[model samples]
Target: MTKLLNVAGAISLLLGFIVSSNAVAVDEQPQSLSQLQSLGNNNQNISNSSLQQGTFNKTNRSGVLLPGEASAQELLPAAEEGLPPPFGANLFAGGYESERSDGLNDDYVVAPGDKVSVWLWGAVNQSEVLTVDNQSNLFITNVGPINVANVKASQLNQVVTERIKQVYKSSVSIYVNLLTATPVSVYITGSVIRPGQYAGVASDSVLYYLKRAGGIDSERGSYRSVKVLRNNEVIKEIDLYDFVLGGYLPRFNFKDGDVILVERQQATILVTGSVRNPFRFELDKDESIGTDLIKIARPYAKVSHVGVVGDRADGPFSIYVPFAEFAQFQLKDGDRVFFNDDIRAQIFDIQVAGSYLGPSYFAVKKDTRLYDLLAHIEVDPNLADFQSVYIQRKSVAQKQKELIDQSLERLERSVFTAPASSDGEASIRLQEGQMILQFTERARKIVPLGKVVIAENGKIANVLLEQGDIVHIPAKSDLVQVGGEVMMPQALVYNENATVEDYIAWAGGYSERANYEQIMVINPNGMVRLNATGALKPGDQILVLPKVDAKIMQNVKDITQIIYQIAVAANAIK
Candidate 1:
């Protein structure tokens, strides 16, 4: 009785406050079909006078809408941020405009305006689609009115069949089915994207109306306590998490003027990374345990550790805990949790390409050396060029790419930022900058092979092998190649007695743009020698670099350095 009095006093106080604020409280009617459609057209427009009354006037405890009271849309991050949309936000993506009323559930209660198809044969032949009247009675042609207002659809067949049997006396065969359910206009209020009246069939699930109302306000709306109010009392309470975590939504029939009040969000925790459902989850209480969060997060198999960060009594705090001990960890309101795959692997796989007869891939320990694996690699002695073996590492490629990008950036900055003393110099610089820009774009597309020189001076270095390394053993080749700024770039028969100049001469000499001083002789194992003039061996490549002439000596130097960087990184000239 004391608690009831306290509630009564609170209600009286709320009414007095509403009157004093000059806010007239009236029964808002459900919108028409056109108005409902217009409401969904723009979610921003739906929060007009009705929404202000529902969200601010009535639900506002302090009689004023605080800045902290934000709608669902306001809570979401900007689309430009590339963040994931809030959980259950996609539920209102539309398609709730029309729902089949014929698919009725067994527990659906009979209501006014609901159509029932009754067919009779045998003694009496009558087929009629009867509508339920206001008094919840379906009037038959000859039989008296049958009360089916509150009767379940499942029991309607039994009730109507028994009544017809009484009238026809075992001669009439009756078949009754709930043809169409009554359409209802439900008032959706509280923390939702659009707080307005939405029209849907009585048989339609609660999600239909919620979807039509633009789903729950992800930021402010409480998915844990969605109430369906009839008259002034709550008839059903829906927990959307039950539907999200476990595919379960409570069954309920909505009536006209029914209010679905989504209470403001309670305590929440933001979960991200290495979890199946990485979204902000609302808690039933201010404080919960890791076990409660585990049920919602559903971390992936690779996730072994959890990092939690939030405020504490002392100050802001953070802790990294193993997945096993997370169950016992205490979680607070507004905490941020991140699951991580922190455990290092004991063994990693590496691929071996070219000339080896054994398995293409091998899973080896972290301390496995290149020489240890090389000893086990079965190769044809006549075909395999073991002396030209090298390792291609992904990490090396990434580092080489970074260095090339940094050099290109520096080259671009130098070309564009060079001080021009006169208009003629500026014009020349502008034209040169454009040409350099084109060259830089072409250079940027080159992917470095990341060749690690394991063999030098005919000796293989037994270095530790890294993850994702490709150990390549070249095939025996008796061909010498000549390319880059040469008149005719082609592969020719290997001449062991020929020098670097002889290979360039055999390829029809250098072009007009070729830099005579910048000739490079590349070995089969990716070792580059500048202006090498000794006797060239088989599988050797002679590349003639292009000349770079700039008015500024620094520009010429930078371009030459970039050329060398590209030649070493990609083994090609730009």
Candidate 2:
């Protein structure tokens, strides 16, 4: 009895396990469309029943999961009912349906030469067809051409009714059919895949004409640069690329006589001057720097200098840069890049001496001009004559011919020449590590005689100076002498190119009492009267004289009048 009970218990446990698995599988199954709708209806019913019982919870009795069991197909109609029509939809859909029926007639008026069609409702023998041509009046009718062509179907029905009323007076209806329709033609040309004249089509819309002309040529055409020409003039540029690629709808519709044209791309960046391959490169992207120019010149180019030449609407600019340092530069479209092969070597030392720059000394590459060394040591302009400047140069065997040629050119141009034996004359080339000494016989004599006017507010006293050297200025004097009067006058030492107006300005200019219109300049050459606009010379004296006042002139005139009256009275007495 114990063995039998154990086997029975195992069988019952297996059966329970199988039933539980089947229950889970049934719960995981997907419901059909009809079943889903039934389930939704049941839920709604349950909520309603709970509400009637007055024991419904807030969460359980809110609403049904799918109200009214709405399907996916019904959702669009439901949404559209709650919204307004899209733009142009109301006008495009059934907007012109009311103006369709205005002409209708059914009647037959027979003439001897007229053809007419007539039909009775149930009598075929009463039907007749007739025609009228080239007569002032119909043979069997009283209707005329003026009355036939201008008459509407309804008006013709009224005329037939009046005629019938004269003969029997019967009511009748009439109908008319047009044998021809209106003609329309449009022409499509320029930048299209196939261009021709099309007929029986709408002439006012570009999209309608484009569809007739095989649309845009995407493989060989640019949709962005399309231009529409109307009556030989550009009306608009249609960006079809934006419409096709960006999903943008066009705003303005087309009109009659429009011509569409597509523009070609423009080439940019003219690379010329010493480049291996010089051509106009087209800019495919946003490029505004000189890097691409360097890349174009990298092959078969030394690139010693890269010159950027640009011309805007305002003006033009030219900038030269070393090729090694041109990486920091930027370029614009239409800019020209000139690649040169001639490279400049760096200078080690430059010389300084005499009227020259200095003794030959090693210097940097780009710092070997004449003005650079002149600023270093204080050189008196009055004592150091710069006009007769010269330079001494040394060259190895390899550079002998070139240096000689350069030297001869410099001498011919007077860049380097011999000195003149005078107070304001000297010459010599400067070498490196050499000192320059400038001296003048007059400077030595005037050093003991005190300061002479080298410049205004600056004095020069030549102490121990030698030949081929420079001198320093110590102090300046303020005294300027004015000999003749014009206005407030003073004295000034004469400069090399001093003029009469400069002296007048130094003496506080012309005063109000002075006659500036007539100024007299006195020099060793003699007195010369001149206007205020006249040029002045060194060692010249200016005379600023005051005009006679009006009061003094009036007093003199009164005295003369009194004397004349006395003389006249005495003569009358005699």
Candidate-wise lDDT, in order:
0.72, 0.37
Candidate 1 Cα misplacement greater than 4 A, ranges: 1-85, 98-107, 152-155, 550-554
Writing each residue's lDDT as its tens digit, candidate 1 over 232-267 gives 999998888888778998887888889999999988
Clashes of each: 0, 55
**Model 2 agreement with the true structure over 188-283: per-residue lDDT tens digits:** 675556778654311133454555566544333444456767778877766553453356744343333445564443224555556655544434
**In terms of TM-score, how similar is model 1 to the real structure?**
0.80
List the lowest-lDDT window of 10 residues for candidate 1.
Answer: 16-25
TM-score of each: 0.80, 0.17
- lDDT, residue 7, model 2: 28
Sum up the clashes in candidate 1.
0
